[model samples]
Target: MAWSHYREMIVWQKAMDLTDEVYHLARSLPKEELYALSDQMRRAAVSIPSNIAEGYGRQTDREFRQFLSVARGSVFEVETQLEICIRQNYLSVPDAKTALALCDEVGRMLTTLSRH
Candidate 1:
């Protein structure tokens, strides 16, 4: 339970990768989506790792678990938003596979971490 740094945690690292992937996908969206879907996706993607680091800083397992719960919610938010993009034809499933996979991995990691 004693992590030297949030960056040292695989879940946190994977979340960061997911955030980066989301940003890349957001950039490919149409210009009109810049302030709408793009902005929202970026925010949700950021929330994942931000909550992880914030909770890690709390230095208590209980508080950290609570933060993980929040991060997991963000994961769902990103998944929903990504699916919307696909449904709207803004992105292809092929283009989103990496981000979606990252989301799933991060979500599962949060679940396991929260249980601790």
Candidate 2:
């Protein structure tokens, strides 16, 4: 199957899972953070899949690859924010660990796709 059709794509599936986890995590943040970290995390989470879907729908390998690059950047952005969250004591060690691992997986997937 093509890169666009990796049904068992751990990255895509993990991205989806990460989005859900972010939503759940955001719920625990202080209400004042609603427009801050919570909002940023949600947007970053959404960007991952949005980029993938937009790229896949572009109907050209170059366009798809370009969007994948965007998605990869978002993954890094999220990872960095996650570290900040840890430093701020906003997220527990386990939560940060899991989120970072998922982001790493997405990064690896994007890199593999780029090489194709």
Candidate 3:
């Protein structure tokens, strides 16, 4: 399919889903972490889709690929934060597991999309 908008991209869609999951996970954290780990994780999660959309708005594939790289970095950042949450006992292993799985899926989608 010829995607005319960023929303049409499967990576962006998956990123959106990841973002939602991250937000849900963040809400379960302690209020003391509102400005720390929770906020950082939320920002990283949001960056994936935001960068994808921004890159899609660029005129060249090169620019889009650059943005995809940024999005990929955010995916790793989210993954790392999720790990921290697990280690800190802020998030359960099962909850972190689900978020981590989404991260992997979004990362794979970003890799596939960037290749094009």
Candidate 4:
């Protein structure tokens, strides 16, 4: 289907949701992590949707696919960071379920999009 805007895409919308959740999660981290793990998580989370929007705006199909790949990688990065937080006792598993689910969803969507 042809989408007029990136916002109209379900994947993009989900990614934005993921970003929001990650930001909230980051806020729960210790003050020492404000410039460390927290910032890294925020940046990776933000990259997912940002890359999607940027790719959607690109002129060429290859460029769009490239950006989607970047976004996909960011999804994995965020997932790893989430795991790190969990292991570090910064966040509990129950508190991270939603964001992790979103990460999985976004990663799958990006993979599907990049294939076409």
Off by over 4 Å in 1: none
Q: Which ten residues in a row have the lowest lDDT in candidate 3?
A: 1-10
Model 2: residue 75 alpha-carbon error in angstroms: 0.5
Positional deviation of residue 100's Cα in model 3 after best superposition, in angstroms? 0.8
For candidate 4, write residues 1-116 as lDDT tens digits. Answer: 38988899999999999999999999999999999999999999999999999999999999999999999999999999999999999999999999999999999999998998
List the candidate 4 regions with Cα displacement exceeding 4 Å: none
Lowest summed lDDT over 10 consecutive residues: which window, candidate 4? Answer: 1-10
* Pairs that collide, model 3: none
Q: Give the Å error, residue 93, model 4.
A: 0.6
Listed per candidate, the RMSD to the true structure in angstroms reads 0.8, 1.8, 1.2, 0.8
| C-alpha lDDT of candidate 3 relative to the true structure | 0.92
Off by over 4 Å in 2: 1-8
Model 3 misses residue 74 by how many Å?
0.2
- lDDT tens digits by residue: candidate 2, 1-116: 36546445666778888788778877877788899998998899889988887777786889988988998999998888788788888888797777788888889988898768
C-alpha positional error of residue 39 in candidate 3 after TM-score superposition, expressed in Å: 0.7
For candidate 1, the TM-score is 0.97
Task: Report clashes for each candidate as comma-separated counts.
Answer: 0, 0, 0, 0
Whose TM-score is higher: candidate 2's or candidate 4's?
4
